[model samples]
Target: MSHSRVNNQPAGQHGMVVAPGGGGNRNAQNMPVDADGRDWSNGLCGCCSSCGTCICATVLPCVVYGKNKHRYQHLDQQGTPEPSPGCCSGSCVAHGIFAACGLGFIFQMVNRGHVRHRYNIKGSGCGDCCTSFWCSPCQLVQESREIELEEQSFGTGRY
Candidate 1:
């Protein structure tokens, strides 16, 4: 069976007819029609905005680390390092250092979680199953550590 480009379509509905340069198909079900009545299949719509993409990228990390105490502490203490000339040097200076070093470490740890891929069972037997990889910041890191241990035991350098 051929996969359809349309995200969602009712049963027995004709799929969007895709052509070069995003031509073809004028049906509302296949393409989202805008207020101006322009056909989105003709490339009238603008690409996703930078802010939208950033939100998409940041959301996973936020969801994963938002509840963690360490992540909260790191964010709460950001950019306070190295006291100003007139500022007091006690807690302020300490906080500044913590923000600088702590934020970097925390970001690194969170980013690592954001990039690691996960797999899911696709079919009945191992031979029939296909692996799908997804990057999810919410994934437990201990699972990754366990996978690493298994790989080491099998003498696999990386997988």
Candidate 2:
């Protein structure tokens, strides 16, 4: 690997040593090294998860992985047919969001319980732009407010 600064400076100019490797001896000038002896690539550095693909590596951390993992788990529970014990947690909401986002159905069965009803009510207005189903109640309130505003405007002959 060829080491260079984020600004594209050669590693040697920044006191970086050439590791004993056949690949290009590249080291980022300002990045921290990790416990595994791998340089902590900057946020812009492209690295793949264990799945061997980096397509969504950066965006997935915040929106698809970590805390979002719970979302996936949630959808899987709600969407599955056979009720798995693991699905009872909040993971179903996350899973449903992930599934709705085109991640595919991880859940074994689809359970259209009150949870799904709430999701349907919320998703109807914005086509499911909201990521978490838990926000359905809030969405309903917002929808009502919007309706009230529309009615008031119409009544005032403002179209």
Best by lDDT: 2
Q: What would the TM-score be for candidate 1 when compared with the true structure?
A: 0.17
Question: What is the lDDT of every predicted structure here?
Answer: 0.28, 0.30
Q: Cα lDDT for residue 55, model 1?
A: 39
At residue 40, candidate 2 shows an lDDT of 22
Candidate 1, residues 116-136: lDDT per residue as tens digits? 211111112221111111322
Q: After superposition, how far is residue 5 of candidate 2 from its true place, in Å?
A: 68
Q: Write the per-residue lDDT of candidate 2 for residues 1-159, one digit (tens) a residue.
A: 455445584444332333222112123123443332322222212222222223332223222232223332333344322122232334545654665675422221122122223222222212333422433323222322222222333233321
Pick by TM-score: which candidate is best? 2
TM-score of each: 0.17, 0.18
Positional deviation of residue 87's Cα in model 1 after best superposition, in angstroms: 38
